[model samples]
Every structure is written in structure tokens, then in C-alpha cells.
Target: MPAPASAPAPAPPSPHPLRTRPFRLLFAGRTLSLLGDAAIPAALALAVQEATGSTAALALVLACSMVPKLLLLPLGGVMGDRFDARTIALAMDLVRCVTQLVVGVQLLGGTPSLAVIASVEVIGGAAGAFATPTAAPLVRGTVPEAGLQRANAAMAVAHSASRVGGPALAGALIFTVGPGWAFVLDAASFAVSAALLCAVRIARVERPAPGARPSVLTDLREGWREVRTRDWYWSSLIGHSAWNGAAAVLMTLGPGIAVHRLGGGAAWVALLQTGAIGLLLGSLVADRVSPRRPVLTANIGLATYALPLLLLAAGAPAVVVIGAYGLAQAGLGFLTPVWETAVQRAVPEHALARVTSYDWLLSFAAMPLGYALAPLAASTWGPGVPLTVAALVVAACCLGSALLPGVRRFTGGPDPVAPAGAEAVSLPGTR
Candidate 1:
């Protein structure tokens, strides 16, 4: 008998994802783009206050930017699914570049009216709706399955760093030059991002031939089907929305508690900075963490948010609140990359963007509601009551989601069972 064949040599370990030129371009472009995007809140708030002065006017301008983005997200999902996602993303970058450039030039020339500012912001925000959902597909297209977690974690780190750096950058520019220059820099950032995108070569996802293409309504139906069919997906989304709503309450109340009970503005600033740092650390660690049930583990991590809320409700010392808040933010940071990678792996490439849009829409819609309701709840029952309630809600929702049958066992691939005759959708090696 022939000697038993020796086991084949193991395949060489894949190179670090960043070592790949395409992912490197993608990583750099998104980081720079997010840095610019992060600068917006601070710079825009100041610019609006100077231009309009009234808090109500400022709120209206901000709402104008947000509401359209939310309203058009479904359509954005369809566009991402229907077209070449990279091209759509690139075009949106150009559109935003033009819009931001126009806004910046106008601001520099003189204070544009609230109407003018709001109008331009609507255009920019609408572009963002289309742009946002394309991200997962782009990552999946550009990186190997083995690298997905690392790629996402790397991006998450960039995001957390940008959240810190962007505000500081904006503040410096606003003080030295003007807020107008910040927007100009943002526009320049988008232009650079677009150029980088022009160089990226994403794997083509096969689309239906033109003659057989589905209608937008059909696409929407299919996307919904994809979501509703996955008990894990829809259930997790509901839990995530609850988490968002509860977090909003904490955000709405934390500053006041910090300033009045803990210390002063410095206390709140320190807490924010600590949270940002925790986010950076958590993102760094996410790539190394592999759990048997990733979705369940991530939700368990998310439930930690309750600790900070409970601390705040008790009027804990600044140091205590700072520690709790940092821990909670770290949980959030870990959840971000792990959750993104899980969804990318589980969902079919054809409908990934659409599914993600639903993820964005529901989770985001809850936030404004939470913000609006938190004050009312506090006014009626006191801040402690709301904060305590938020803590319970967050913990319950996240833990409940984690316990859901589908999520508890999910291993980042298609459901093992499929409808009769339909092929199960899955990424190789994911299961």
C-alpha cells in the first residue's frame, strides 16, 4: 500500500489587511472623510449660532439636515443595491463636495440666512443618506472574508480617533480663521476622498441584466423579505433601537449631572475625552476577540451601558461616572465593528446595503424620540427616575436580544435552513 499521504502544508497566513493596496486606499479615504464629517457638528453649531443666534433657528437648521437623510434612506438603499455601489458612493462624495464648497464660500462671503443654510444642508444630508449604506458592500468587496473583522475594527479606530481629533481641529480653525474655513476644509476632504475612491477597485457584484432588473418597489420588498426572514436580524434591530433610545436619555441628561452634581464643565469634558479614549481601545481589541456566538457576545457587551446610566442616576462621583462612562463607551466601540462584520458576513452581497439601511433607519429614528422624551420624562418624574428607567430599558433590551434563539446561535452566515428549493446564502468559511 502506498504510504499514507502527509497532510498538505497549511496555506500561508494572509497578509495584514492594510498591506493590501485597495484596502489601504479605502482605509485612508474613509478616515480622512470621517475626520471631515466629525468636524461638522462643532463647526456647524458655531456657524449657525453666529449666523442665526436663536437656538430654535439652529435646531431647525439641524433638523433640516437630519430629517431628509432619514426620510430618503430607503431610497438610498435601493440605489446602492441597484447600481455600482462604489460609483454611487463616489458620486455622492462629489455632490457633497459641491454642496459643502458652496456653503463654505457663502459663509465666508457673509452670513447666509437660515433658509439658505438649511436648504444647502438638505442637499448635503440627502447625499449622505445615499452614501452611508454603501460602506459595508465596499468593505466586503475590497477585503477577504478572513480580514473583515480587522478591517472593520481598523475603521472603527479611525472613527473614534476622528471623533476626538475632528472637534479639536474644527475648534482651532474656527478660532484662528473662521468656521467657514472648517467647512472649506471639509469640502476639500471630500474631494480628496473622491479622488481616492477613483483609485479603489471593488469586486463587482453581479447585477441582473438590464432587461430583467427588478423595480424599485420590488427591490424594497425583497430587502424587507431578507430582513424579516432572519429572526436574528429583525429582533436584533429592535433591541438596537431600544439601546439607542436609552443611550439618548443618558446623553441628554449626563452633562447636567456632571456639571451640577459631579463637578463643572471640566468634569463633562473629561468624561467625553475618556469615553473617546475607551472607544479607541475597544476598537483596537475587537479584532482579537472571537466568540462562539458573536452577536450574543456583542449584545452582552452593549448591556454594560446600564452601569453608567445607573451611576449617573445615583449622582456618583465624577471619577466614578467617568470610569463607568468610559467602560460603556468601550462596549459600544467593541460592538460597532463586531456588529458590522457580522451583518456583512450574514447578509447576501446583493442586498447588503439595503439591509444595512434598515439597520440605520430604525436605530437612528429612535434617537430623536429618546432625546425629545427624556426631558419630558425628567420634568415629570425627575432626572433620576428617567436615568434609572433608561438603565433598565437598555439592559433588558440588549439582554433580551442576546437571548433570542436566532441571535444566540448565529455564527455569521446564512441560516442553515432555507425555503424549499432556494439556495442558502452564505460566505465561504463564515459558518
Candidate 2:
């Protein structure tokens, strides 16, 4: 009998650079989109408060915006892996533009019904669920192995810039032309982002052959299974989950405490946010200072975040509080690039979107719940007590995660170029 046919060997992955044209365009688009995102939340919160005079109701509006993303994040990841990310991203941007435009019109034409505003926010959030996961895999596609760190660093800086500028700009717009103008500005920003994405052409790669189409439950199970099998994956997920949970509480309740209890309002919030801006500047310089030991550096930074909260708990004056907050944010900013690069290098490309989605889902799962609990916790335990506890919990999680064997030892050093016969993995669509 003739010899059995040999199985085909896997193909090698391609080499690419972080500074490629497509990546640059995508990065620019993301920065623009984030800036808009920042503006909308602040403007929306103010609008709701002005119309209803109910903090609880405004909280509900915010909850509606986040719930869809939290619920659909995993499914969104699957879609990214199954389709072209660029197409998904562009479509999502257009949808958001329309949603924001509608919102802008409603606000400009005298206040619309609260129901209408809430409905629009939920719709926009649904669109965001599609946009976020699609964008996760794009970084892997645009940059080469050696350049992943730099690419992630650049992205972190851009994200920080949006966070820093978005609210400030929104406040200014709201003060000058009303909330309607802020929403309009946000809509225009999304439009510009969509056009930029449309102008770029991303090369698609091959995907794994499908065996059987899995049910949604099965798909989720498979994703979980994949995560369970990786050491760094679980450690990173747990760490981020704890961090985000604590952050959710502080972000939701801290401002209120500062305003009502501490006799500081929007100005205090702005001061704290400005501190976070300083962190962004630090993150921009992180790549140049610590290119290789990102994980270790990030772990150290995570520890520092606790300091600010601890100081705030002690009733520090406004200047001291702002300085502490800035220090914490600067540390976090430096950590973001390192953490992103670690994840990109650790996970296989085929599974990257699924893993990222899972990461996001787990991390953000507690956010809405935290928001709900913050007020209750304050009522039960007193204002400063909840903030103190939340900060402590965050510190503990950071320390605990860093102590994990995988996280402590995992050094995704510069990966070598793929040799011949290696299989290349495809990144999910940008949509």
C-alpha cells in the first residue's frame, strides 16, 4: 500500500511593525472616539440631573449604558474572531454617531422625556458592545512582536488623553452652549473617527477551520475553558476584576462624598481628574524608561494607587487630595501599557479576542453592581468608611494578584520572528 499522506504543516506567522500606516490610522481613530466617549458621560449625567433632580435616576441612566456592554462583551468577542473587525468598528461608529445626534437634537429642542434619553443611551451602549471587542484584536495585527510594547504604550497615552480632555471639554461646552452642544460635539467626533477608519485598509489573516457550530452557552464555556488553561490569564483577570470593582465604588461615590461631605463639587472632581491627567503624561514616557519589565513595573504601580485613597480617608485638604490622586493616576497610567502588552504577548492570536472579551467582561461585571452598592454602602457604613474599604480591597487584590506564580514569573520577553512552517493567527474585525 502507498504511504499515507502526510498532514500539512502549519504556516508561519508574518512579521509586521508597530509603526505601520494602518495602525497609526486606527490609533488616531480610537483616540478621537474615546475623547467623544468621555464627553458624553459627563454631559449626559448633568442633563439627567438637571431634568430629574434625582441622583438615583441619573445612576440608572449610567447603569443602562454599562449593562449592555457587560452582558454582550463575550458575544462581541466571538463576533470579532468570526468576522472582519474593521467593518464592525466602522458600523459601530456610524451607529453611535446617529445615536448621539438624536440625543443632541432631543436635548437642544427643550428637554425630551427621561424615557427617551434612557432608551437612546441603552441603544448606544449596545453598539459599544460591538465596537470594543472588535478593536481589541487590532493592536496585535498592526504591530510586530518587538513593537507590541511601544504600540500599547502609545495607545495608553491616547486613552489617557481622552480621559483627561473629555470631561474638561464637556464641562466647558455645557457651561457655554448647553449640554446639547456637547452631545453635538461628541457626534461630530465619532463621525470623524468613522471616516478615518473607513480610509484605512487592514489585511486579513486566516482563521482556524470550524468544526461544529457551538451554542452560545457552549461558546461561553469554551472561552472559559481557554482561560482556565492559561496561568497568566486567570491571574490577570482576577487582578483586574478586583481593581475595577473597587474603582467602580470609588468613582461612583467618591465624587459625591467630596462634594456633599467634603464641601467640594465640580471643581474638586476636576482637580482629581487633573491628577489622573498627570498619570497619562507619565504613561507616555513609560515605554522609554522600562521597555522589558512591564509586568513587574505595573505591579509596583498598582500598589501606589492605595496611597491616595488612604490619604483622602484621613480628610486631607483639597490640594493634598488632588496631589495624592494625581500620583495614583500617574502610577496607573504607567501600568496600562505594560499590562496590555503582557496580555497581547501571552495569548494566542486565534484566541485573543475571546480572551480579551472575557477579561473585559469579568473586570466590568462588578461596575454596575458597585455603582448600585456605593450609595447603599455609604448609607450603611458612613461616607468615608465605604471609600476606605474599597481602597483597601483594591490594594489587597493588587498585592494578591502580583503574588500569583504566573503573574510574578511570566515574562513575555520579545518574541522571536516566526520560523517557516508556523501557523499565523488572525485578529478579529475592528468593528
- Using all chains and alpha carbons, the TM-scores for the candidates as numbered come to 0.95, 0.85
Query: What is the RMSD, in Å, between candidate 2 and the native fold over all Cα?
Result: 7.7
Lowest summed-lDDT stretch of 10 residues in model 2? Answer: 414-423
In candidate 1, what residue range of length 10 has the lowest lDDT sum? 418-427
The CA lDDT of each predicted structure is 0.86, 0.74
Give the poorly placed runs of model 2, Cα more than 4 Å off.
1-19, 208-213, 256-263, 413-431
Deviation in Å, model 1, residue 314 alpha carbon: 1.3
Report the number of the highest-lDDT candidate.
1
- Give the clash count for each candidate: 0, 11
Off by over 4 Å in 1: 1-4, 418-431
Q: How well is each residue in 254-354 modelled by candidate 1, as lDDT tens digits?
A: 88887889879899899989999999888988978867787888888888889988988987788998999899889889989998998887777878889
Task: Give Cα distance to truth, residue 131, candidate 2, Å.
Answer: 1.2
Task: Quote the lDDT for 209 in model 2.
Answer: 52
Cα RMSD (Å) per model? Answer: 2.2, 7.7
